[model samples]
Target: MAKLKSLMSCAANRLQQASGLDQTEARIEIRALMQHSLGGVNHAWLIAHGDDTVTDALRVRFESLLARRIQGEPVAHILGRREFYGRDFAVTPDTLIPRPDTEILVETALDRIPPDQACEILDMGTGTGAIGITLALERPHAQVTILDYSEAALAIARENARQLSAHNVAALHSDWFSAVQGQRFDLIVSNPPYVEADDPHLQQGDLRFEPITALASGTDGLDDIRRIVAHAPMHLKPSGWLIIEHGYNQGEAVRSIFSGHYFANVHTVQDLAGHDRVTLGQLT
Candidate 1:
């Protein structure tokens, strides 16, 4: 059996060569693969045993997962979960992988919600229940409705809610507002599909593996965003808020959609990248 450190180093180098990840990122991915293949052990365990020898079974499982990573599969797909807002939420190809930038949407909405009140929130396109579940967990008094068009995605969302103990939320199947026709919410948040259908990025990297419907909208990528904004006024309680995530370059268009829909306090929030990433507005 190879030493754990040697095995990790070899796998990391191979992954880096295959995927173009830098040394540090390659090592991190290898570490995550190790922790998972070793049956969900924590990072400290890997640190404590860095000098240990790898068991044959562990070597086999780790190498198998590493091979998948080398083939460009997302680590979250291999591990079956992704961390968002500091929580590991279950994920699958059926749902969009929870990304760090989406946390900005969560934080922006979380800051707007009063902690002690029974705020009603609707998370449209809640793929893994990351947004709605995090909101419900953060503001326990808040009741969040997690809606998705895909039943498979909604199943993942529901499972994530239960696994995370986010009891204050409900997962509903809907194509946008189809299932919630007249239901008004104190806040409506969405990380909708905003990538243009023909965008070349869709053919590369992790995008290659994610569901297309969760990533692309219409030709300009604003079709779903427009639909969400156009129908938001009916679902939002007067004086309530609407927050949505979009492509960094599409902020101005999203803000215009909100403004044209008569949403007041319309504005866009930039993620850490200084790119406009989230747009929010309030109902008059």
Candidate 2:
């Protein structure tokens, strides 16, 4: 049997060659695969136990995962979980993997919700329940409703909410606002499908493994955004806030939509990449 350190180094090299990832990212993937296969080990533990011998059984398990990744299955899907805003959210093929960029949506929503107030928040198209669950945890007093059209995706989100003990969050199935009917909320946020149907990125990288219905919109990728903006006023309470994450190049168009709807203080916020990622406005 090979030493654990040597086995890990070989796996990282194979991952790097297959995925074109840098040495740092390759090592991270190796660490995640190692932990998943070996069990009971974290990054710190792996570093401390590098000299441990790799048993034949453990080597088989580790290589199986690495091979799957090399063949293009998403790392999150393979691991059955994803980390978002310091919480581990269970994810599957039915649900889009929670992304780091969406954390900006949660942070912006946090600014709108008070720590002590019993605010009503809506998370539309919620997948993995990351945004809603994180907000519910952060503001224990706030009630968050997470809505999704896909029952399978909703199952994953509900499970995540349960595991995270987000008691203030409720999961509902709806094709948009159909289930809410006459109800309204003080705040509504979403990370809806903003990728153009023909966008080449959909066929590349981890995107290839994600559900297309959760990623692609209309030809220009503004179909869902337009529908959400048009219908949001109906559900938002007086002075309620509406925030939505969109494609980077869509800042101008989204801002214009909000303005046309007579929303107040309409503007766009850049992500860590400095791309216009989230746009928000208050109900007039």
lDDT of 1 by residue, 121-172 (tens): 9999999989999999999999999999999999999999889889999888
Which parts of model 1 have CA positions greater than 4 angstroms off?
none
Give the Å error, residue 229, model 2. 0.3
Model 2 pairs in collision? none
lDDT of each: 0.93, 0.93
Specify the poorest-scoring 10-residue window by lDDT in model 2. 38-47
Q: Which candidate leads in TM-score?
A: 2
